[model samples]
Target: MQLSVTLIIIIVTTLVSISGFSSQKIIDDLIFYPPAVTQQRQWWRFFTCGLIHADFGHLILNMYALYIFGVEVERAFVSIFGKYGNLVYLLMYVSALIVCLLPTYRKHKNNYYYRSLGASGAVSAVVFCFILLFPLRKLGLVFFPVMIPGFIFGTLYLIVSTILERRSSDRINHSAHIWGAIYGIVFLIVAANFFSTYPVLQSFVEDVKGWLASF
Candidate 1:
């Protein structure tokens, strides 16, 4: 059996992230250091940084989220784009790692102290894309008893991420999450329009409308 792009990403990211846990050099080289890119022109860090993570928890959470949603998203892409689905999916994931971090790069390009390493941005892109494709799908929290639709969860996520990003109280890069999600939605819409004749936005709207009508 052939390995899906999602599984391949998980494997590669997991191995590199685990290696970085013990090797500072590995993290130093792969991590997104704005100064490094600004000074040394190591722009590859934008995409390579996703291969390494801050820690085990960070790696696991991102990979798990990607696995949970990426497979479905891949299938959806295949359905929409035919033979080129896997390629498109791969491009989206890699490009998201860069696009999601562009704002951070601009803000910290000269700040030597700023460094980030994780796949949260790309994972958020995949999760948000899934939510866009299935807005009415039920989403549940770990400790919460109530389950809400995907769109509601996405909205709440964006709101909380925005507030936290504005506060700048923690090291978490919430800005990346916000941009990645928006990029995911836009990527799908544009890809569909350019590569296929599918009316993706129209279909999403119809799905949402049908779900609302049922209430």
Candidate 2:
């Protein structure tokens, strides 16, 4: 069996996150600390922050989600973009890490107490990309007992993320979730239009219609 890029990412992230559990320095240096980025110019945190997670639960949830969706998204990209697919996949993930946090950075760039660490942003990007290709697929959250269509799930997710982002009542980076998903859909549309002959939007409509007709 061949090792996939998705598996490779999961292994590396799990190792780094576990190591960070013992080494506070690792977390501090790698965590997305806006003040550090703004004052000391430590820009790497934008990407490195995704390597460490807050706890075992956080790590597991993000990694599991990433693995489930990322593998399919990677495969789909290869089919769509051919030789440049891997590069595009990498670009989307890496860019999502930074782009998803831009809102947080702007709002808290001077706040010394603000810090976030995890792969949730990048994972959201992968999941949404998968959703775009498989809009009619069934999906269900662990806590949410009912299975729903992928596109419907994505829509509800964005709405919830937006609400949580505005509330700002918890430590979770809801903004990252919202923006990462947007980036994923936008990336797919732009990439397909410019680099491939795939009828992404048309296909999406047909898939939705097919799903609707089934009911």
Candidate 3:
């Protein structure tokens, strides 16, 4: 199922790119960016923005992460939710976008020219979900080139994104990533509470507690 979904994402992205539909342009034209406001507002842009990527490199990177982490998260979700797994995935993706847009909207409501593109928020959702589902797994950092356990990595990621949100002016949506991670963590906890069969998430919470205690 994971492989199938990954292939579908790649195919859809590639087809969209080949059709001359730039993801960045889509984001610029639609999504809830402050700068995108015009006399004629297109509300559908909010959902379409995530499907668009700035370039091939951007698309490839995001798709790769989606394929890598998304599959595992999907499997775990299916194991727990059974028939409701797809619904959870859909909700997580949409929730990430909503959370991502709010902070930008709050900060730039008056500017009406703020723009952002890419699927970083949704990608963060998958990455963080993976971390929660597999807290003991080691994650390799691209910058540091080292592997760290999932819980530590997830915590560090949240912290780094939060810190960068305050200090950086880079194009990357660090705030969206941080917020998406928070959403992922919260979603998992809430879902676990409601669905006791999701041992993976339950164990993850326990592992996180144990990791915290070790400090």
lDDT of 3 by residue, 1-215 (tens): 34545456556655764443534454455455654443345545555667676677887888888888987887777777777776777677777777766777567656765666667787788888888888978998677889989888888888888888898778777877887777877786787678646665668778888877998
* TM-score of each candidate structure, all chains considered together: 0.97, 0.96, 0.83
Point to the candidate with the largest TM-score.
Answer: 1
Separate clash counts for every candidate: 0, 0, 4
Candidate with better TM-score, 1 vs 2:
1
> Which 10 residues in a row give candidate 2 its minimum summed lDDT?
2-11
Off by over 4 Å in 3: 1-3, 17-28, 35-41, 199-201, 209-215
> What RMSD value applies to candidate 2?
1.2
RMSD (Å) per prediction: 1.0, 1.2, 3.0
Q: Tell me which of candidates 1 and 3 scores higher on TM-score.
A: 1
The digit string of per-residue lDDT tens for model 1 on 42-92 reads: 999999999998878888888989999999999999999999999999999
Per residue, candidate 2 scores C-alpha lDDT tens digits across 1-215 of 97777888899999999999999999988999999999999999999999999999999999999989999999999899998887889899989989999988999999998899999998999999988999988999888879998999999999999999889999899999998899888889899999999978788889999888988
After aligning candidate 1 to the native by TM-score, how far in Å is the CA of 146 from where it should be?
2.6
